[model samples]
Structures are given as structure tokens and as C-alpha cells.
Target: MTYPKRFAALPEYAFPRLRSLLDHHDPGGDVVHMTIGEPKHAFPSWVGDVLAENTAGFANYPPNDGSPELLGAISDWIKRRYDVGLDLNQIMALNGTREGLFNAAVALCPEETARGERPVVLIPNPFYQVYAVATATVGAEAVFVPATAETGHLPDFASLPPQILNRAEICYMCSPANPQGAVADRDYWAKLIALAEKYDFRIFADECYSEIYRDTPPPGALEVAQEGGADPERVVLFNSLSKRSNLPGLRSGFVAGGPETIRHIRQLRAYAGAPLPLPLQRVAEKVWADEAHVEENRALYREKYKVADEVFAGIDGYMPPDAGFFLWLPVEDGEAAALKLWTETGVRVLPGAYLSRDTDRGNPGKQYIRVAMVAPKQEMRDGLTRLRDCIYA
Candidate 1:
């Protein structure tokens, strides 16, 4: 049997790689997991009630794009959050942004650029894993750009050579970036939008971690595009209820862009997508409409941010995240630090190298470990303290 060769070069996924690295070793102390980004905070109290009320709807097929009510709710939320008014046609519900992120590439990325070359997809190094996979699945060249400290932890698409830029079809950007937690600002969005416009590529802005910030909401790509008067289809923004409402299992997210962009995405989803169950869609509708729960969730993460700051204080190269929950702590070697921390201190964190690709200079994540601060306050504090003592001491 033969398999597609596109995925041949892909490395093992981050978590499984982590398991292979440490599972056989006996932990020296009580185990405290700070690995995956799953939120442990409470989801909205009303979710159960809403699901119960809508359970009957599950007997019927769900709308592939999204129920009218759910789409309207998402549109209203976008208006409230980004100050950008969107027609319902501009939004398509996603099982999760991960699904939409992958499918959007399949639907939007052209097989060949105007120059008649296999289009390139620009991905930030130390990126969300799905971005590279999506590019590969679509038969595009996946160009990994560095998002290291020198670039302020965001990919500099403008710095690419004109030849590469000319063949670009899609650029994936995660604000409140996954491992590094760096938030892209308004200027960054504007510049990226300008570059996308110049190169005729679409920007896939993964704003999944947008709401888990300290102070001041991060600027959004859609809003920035509107402000700059760029083409409506130039930016496709993906957001979710996972981080916002502490409902990762809800698997509810949405992709918003211009009508044509969404039309293409929704058409693809109609045939090949797994629409959210109607009951879950009802739950998402209610969740998107309510901000009280989201605000409460953000408060919990804010407290965790403070705890992390105090724990890592005075430590050189410890850059406090602009927003989002992960702490990208500097280390001599990520794999070694993670293994040692697990075996010696029983604190499990992800090796940063697992999240990034190697370049000529080096893997940017080689000298770091990603610690997710998603456990209960005391548990998280304990884990961080143990990690600090075991490694930094």
C-alpha cells in the first residue's frame, strides 16, 4: 500500500513526542501536569441547562454553516468585540478553529499563484501544529518563518524575498501566539494586511487565545483590515469559545471573512464537514451571547499571570507574555529541561522544540519549555514553584 507523500516529512506531533520522551521514566516526586493548554476553569453555569433544553434539536440534522440563531449570535459578538459589523453570510461555524483552519486552506489556497508556481503558505516557527499540516494537505509549500525574540515573537512576512512572496497564497498568524504568548498589535496587523494585499495572499488569523489576556483587549485582524480599507476577503479570522468561556470540549468556533470567502468555505463544509450537533450549537449560541462568564474566566487567568510573574521574577530572558496563558520559560535545552523537570521534580511541561521547526540558525524553541498555567490556582502555583526550584535553582 502506498500513502500520500505530503505528510512524509512531518515530524511526530508535540504531545506524543512528549510522551515518548518521558513516559518510561519514573517521576521522582508527586506528578503535576502543566503540559497541554486545556483549561481547567469552570465553564458557564448555564451550558447544561441550555443543552438540556435543546436536546430535542439534536434529533434533526444541524445546519452545516451554522444555525441562523447561532450565526446571528456570533455576528453580534464580533460587532461587540471588534467594532466590525458583519453580515451573517460572512461567518461560518466551525467544529473548532482547528477544523476551519485546515479546511480554509483547502478551500481558499489556490493550487497555483498568478506566477504559476505551487503557492506557498507562510507559517510562524513554534506555531500551532495544524498550520503546517493544512499547508501540506493542500499541496502547498510550507515556508516556516522564525517568530523568535528578534522579531518580537511574530513572523515577519515582509522580510521574505520577493520571489517567495510572489508565490504566497496563505499566511497563518496566531495572535497571543501558542507557545510564546506574544500578542500582535494594531501596527503589526496593519503591516501584515498591507503585505497580504501586495502579495495577493489571504491572512488566516488564529485568534483562539484572544480573550485570555491581562489588560486591554488585543487588536483584531478584521478590524485592522477594515480600518486600512483593504479587500474584504484579504483576511480570514478564526476565533473560538474554548479559551473565552473555558469550553474547549464544546468544539465550537467560527471563521469570518468576506462573503465570497465564506461562501467557498461553507460550500466545502456542506459536503465534507462535521457540523456541531444542534444541541451543542444551541449551547454555543448562548455562550457567545454572554460575556459575564468570559470576564470571570479572564480574571482567573489574570491571577495566574501574576503568579507566574512573581514565580519567574528576576530570571533573565523571562519575557512576560503580552496575553494568553502559556509561559515560554528560557532553558539551556528544551528537551533536556523537560525530561529533567519531569524525572527530578515530577513537573511535566512541554519541550518547546517539539512545537517548532529547525532552520539554518537553529530551532528557535530549542532553549525553552512551554508551561501552561491552566490548573487550579494553588495547584498551578505549586507546580510552578516546584519547576522553578528544580530547574532555576
Candidate 2:
């Protein structure tokens, strides 16, 4: 039997590959899990009450696009957070940003761009796996740009060859980027939006980690686009309650952008997607309308950031991320460091290489390890102390 070849060449998913590497080893001490970025913070107290109140809605089929209340909440949140206006038709509730991130490619990417080519989708080298899969799903060229320490942990899309940029259809950028914790500033978003307008491509900005920052909130792509007078049709922003409200299990998120782009996405989704249940949509509306819980959650991440800073201070090549909750620590070889740490200290972590791909120059993540600061404050500190001593010492 023949199978689709598009995914046949993809690298193994990171976690399974990690299990293959260290599953057999027994830790010498209490096992501390610093691998996945699952939040350890408490969710809003009202979530339960809202879910209970709306339990009756679960008896019937839910709206696919989103309930009017939920859509209004999303629109209100966008206006409050980014000062960007989005009509109900311009926003569609997502199962999660992961779904939006992948499905947007299928909906937005053209078979051919201005250059009359298969079009290239610009992806960061150590990027979220979904981006590349989305690019390949559309039968476009997946061009991996290096987001290395040298580049402030963000890809320089402007550096690409003019020919590639001209044919570019979509570029996936993550702010307070996953694994790296690098936030895109106003200038970064402005420049990328300009490039997207100049080349006639769309910007898929993953702002899921937008609420988990240290000091000031990270600037968003849509905000910059509006300020710069770029076409609203040129950008789509994805946000989630996962990191923001500590509700990854809720699978609640939204995609907001130009009316036409979102209309296309909603049209495609109606045929292939299961919308958030009415009950869950009620919970989401309340979640977005309230900001107190989000502020409390951000404070928790801030505490963890302080712990990371204190633990790794004076250590060479240790940089505390500006935002997000992952530490991309430098090492000789990520896999070797992870193995040594697990066997010696019983702390588990993910190799940076697993998060990235090898390019013509090199795998930028090959020399680092990704430590998620998602454990509790005490456990986070303990894990970092153990990791620092075992891996860096």
C-alpha cells in the first residue's frame, strides 16, 4: 500500500524521541520533570462555576464558528490587549492555537505566489513542529531560517534572498517564542509586517505565550501592523488560554484577522472542524472578559523567572529569557547533557536539537537544552539547582 510521502520524511516528534533516549534510565534522586511547558499555575476560580452553569448547553450540538457571546469576548480581548479592532466575522474560536496554526496554511497559502512558483513558507529553524507540517500540507517549499543566539533568538526574514521573499506565501513567527523565550519587539513586528505587505504574503503570528512575560508585555504583530498602516489582510494572530489562563486542557483559543482571511478560514472549518462546545464557549467568554486571573498567572511566571535568574547567575552563557517560561541554556551537546542530567541527578529535560532541524550551516539548537519553568516555584528552583550542578558543573 502507498502512503502520503509528505510526512514520511519528517523527523520524529520530540517527546517520543526523548523517551527512546532516556526511558530506560533510573534517576539517582527524586525525579523532576522540566520537559514540557504545561503550566503549573492555578486557573481562574470562576472556570468551574461557569462550566457548571452552562452544563445544559452540552446536551446539544455547539456552533462551529463560535457562539455570539464567545466571539464578542474574543473581540473585546483583542481590543483591550492589542488595541486592534476585530469584528465577529474576523475572529473564529479555535480548538487551540495549534489547530489554527496548522489550518491557516491550508486556508491562506496560495498554490502559487507572485513569482508563479510553489511559494516558500518561511519557518524558524528551532520552530514549533506545526509550522513546517502546515507548510508541507499546502505543498509549499518549507524554508527554515535560523533563529539562533546570534540573531536575538528570532529569525531575520528580511535576510532571505529576494527571489525567496518574492515567492513567500506565509511566515510563522512566535513571540515570547516557545523554547527560546524571545519576544518580538515593536520594530521586529513592524519590519516583518512591512515585508509581508511588500511581498504579498501573510504573517502567522503565534502569540500564545503573550501573557507569560517578565516586565512589560510583548508587542504583538497585529498591533504593529495597525500602527504601521499595513494591510489587515496581511496578518493573522493566534492566541490561546493555555499559557495565559493556565487552561491548556480547555483547548480554547482564537484566530483574529482581516474579514476576508477569517471568512475563508471559517468556511473551511465549517466542513472539517468541531467547534468549541457551547459550555466551553461560555467558559471562554468569561475567561477572556476577566483579566485578574491572567495577572495572577503572570505573577507566578515572574517568580519562576526570578528563580531562574538567581540559579544561573554568574554562569557562563546562561541567559534568562525576557518572556515565556523556557530556558534555552547553552551546552556542548543537548542530548548528552540531558542524558547525563537524567542518569546522574534524575532531572529530565529535552535536548534543544529535538526542537530544531539541521540546516546547511548547522542545527542552532545542537549546543543547547530547553528547560521549561512550568513546575511550581519550589520545584522549579530545585530542578534548576540540580540541573545547573549536574549539567554545567
Candidate 3:
């Protein structure tokens, strides 16, 4: 059994561990799940019709990268959103950004740095688990950079010692960060791109939650990289229709970068990737081209944001998210708080420690619980109110 040892140090996935901790106990009241980030909003009304119209295409093999029409729609969306024009060669479709995020690392991260050291991948401490898994898959050293409140909830790669940065091959960043819901601004993106350029590393920008904002749109990584006049290949952008269009089940996303970067990624995808089914591709083509439904989705989230604010009002240390839908709320101990909430109030949440690993500075997420704001506004309001009365009151 000479299996790979890279995942040996990795903790079990978050949700299963949450179940082991809470499932045996009987819930004290009616159960209300506010754990996973799956959206409950209605997807576009015409999605079924579109899928039906294209069902015949399912009999044929899908285009490996993306159908030209789907890719064109993605490119057009990017142009409108980021003001950056991209050639079709610079983008490829993804089943979901999860695979894209992992595969991009395998396709882009080097076996060793220029100085002959094992490559280092910089990951925000409380990161999407796939980032660490991808780093491990590629045999790179994972450097967990704390993206706590003091760091504006974003990893500060520039502060790491030059020795660490010198061996860095990839840096993973998520705007509208998953648990914390922090958006990286233009200055943040510019500085991060500059650091990648200085250290000769590439930035893997996960912008999946980019569209669900309250105010202005977040500055995109690719746009910031272009605005800063850095090498176009210095940043790779990964985005999806999941959060943006309430289409998580659609499993449509895209990876875009310079020609060389995409060439390598698409080449790997040809052999190992499962292209989006032609019917699904046709559905996505029309979905990406339409923003009316996306605007409606954002409006719904805005209402939920207001509900959360009113429910948690006047609570000390309550920092409303800049964008995205999760609330990383403070607690004395995340696991204890989550269990108590579940057993006493029947409200489910994820323990922050499950999303983070212990480090010399401590497990950054140990003192919080992540509450997803993805349920319908009224249910979310009910959940938040119960959570507030149970914990804060």
C-alpha cells in the first residue's frame, strides 16, 4: 500500500467532522440548517426550458475546453464585469471551480523552485480546503498565512520573509472570501500581483463569490493585474455560475489566464477533465449572457444582509461582511458553541476550527462559528434571531 502520503497531515473534510460531533445528540427544537453555503434562491426561470431545448446535444461528446458559444459568453461577461478583453484561447470551461482550482495547481505549480527548493504555495489560514489539497497534490510546501481581522481578512503574502516568498510558486486568494466574506480591493490585488511578480509566482484568484455584493462590485484580480501592468500570466482567474447565478447544480465555471497558462491547463483537461455536457453547456451559454436574473439574486441577498444586521445589531464585535453570504461570528470556542446551539436551539452552523488548522500562532478560526446566509430571507432571519437569543442574549 504505497499510497500517497501528501494528505496524511490534512484533517478530515469539515462537514463530516461536524456530523460526528453533533449528529448523535438529539436536537432540542425544530432543526434549521444554516451550515453549508449552498444557495436556496431560485435559479433563472428559463433554465429548464433552455436545458430542454438543447437536450439532443447530450448524445454527442462535448467540446473539451468549452463550446465556442459558451466560451464567447464567458469572455463577454468578463469584459463587462472586469473591463478586460480576453481572447477565446485564454479561457477554458470547468465542471465547477472546485476542479478548476485543484487542476490549475497541478497544471501550474512547479515541482521545485528556481533555487532547487520544494515549491511553496501560500494559502490563507482559513482557506477553501481544496487550496491545501491542491498544494499537497503537487508536492509543494503549504504556507498558511493568517488572514485574521488584523489582516483585513485577507492573506498578507508580502509580509512573509523573503526566504519563504523566494520559494513560492503559487498564491491562492479568494475575493469575497468564503467564511469571512471579505472582498480584496484594488490596492490589495495590485500589491498581491506585485508580490507574485517579485517572487516569480502566480496568483490563483478564486472569484466565485464576486457577484453577490451589497455595494459596488469587487475589483477583479485579472483587471487589477492588467491595471498594474504586470505580466498577464502572473494571475489566473477562476469564477463560476454557482454563487453568481444560483446555479451551483449547473456545475459551470471557467479558468482564464494568458495563452501559455491556459494552453497548459486545457492540455491537462483534455486528458483528465470531464467537460460540461453539451446540454449543460448550452444552458450555461444563455445563462452567462443574461445579467437580469443575477441582479435579482443580488437584491435578494441585500435583503438578507439587512435582516442579519437588524438581528445582530448592538452586539459587540459584530463585523458585517463586505460581500458574500457567510457570517464568521465570534464565540468563546467554535466547536462548543456550535454543539450547544445545535442541541439547545436546533440551529446548525460550522465550527470555524474545522475550516482551519492549528499553527504556531494558533488555529485562527477556533474562536468563531461560520453561519451561512443562503437560506430564504425569512428563514435566515428566523435562524439568526434564534442564534442571537441563544448565544448573544
lDDT (10s digit) by residue, model 3, range 245-308: 9999999999999999999999899889899999999999999999999999999999988998
TM-scores, one per candidate: 0.99, 0.99, 0.99
- Candidate 2 residues 24-117, lDDT tens each? 8888689999999898889988799999999999898998999999999999999999898888999999999999999999998898875678
What lDDT score is found at residue 63 in candidate 1? Answer: 89
Q: What is the lDDT of candidate 3?
A: 0.93
Backbone clash numbers for all candidates listed: 0, 0, 0
Error of 1 at 40 (Å): 0.4
Assess each prediction's global lDDT (C-alpha) against the native.
0.94, 0.91, 0.93
Off by over 4 Å in 3: none
lDDT of 3 at 368: 92
Q: Work out how many backbone clashes candidate 3 has.
A: 0
lDDT of 1 by residue, 1-393 (tens): 988999999999999999999999999789999999999999988799999998899789998899999999999999999999999999999998999999999999888888789899999999999999999999999999999999999989899999999999999999989989999999999999999999899999999999999898999999999999999999999999988888999999999999999999988998889999999999999999999988899999999999999998998899999888899999999999999999998999999999999989789999999999999999999999999998889
Question: In model 3, what lDDT does residue 124 have?
Answer: 92
Which runs in model 1 stand beyond 4 Å of their true positions?
A: none
Residue pairs in steric clash, candidate 2?
A: none
Candidate 3 minimal-lDDT segment of 10 residues: 374-383
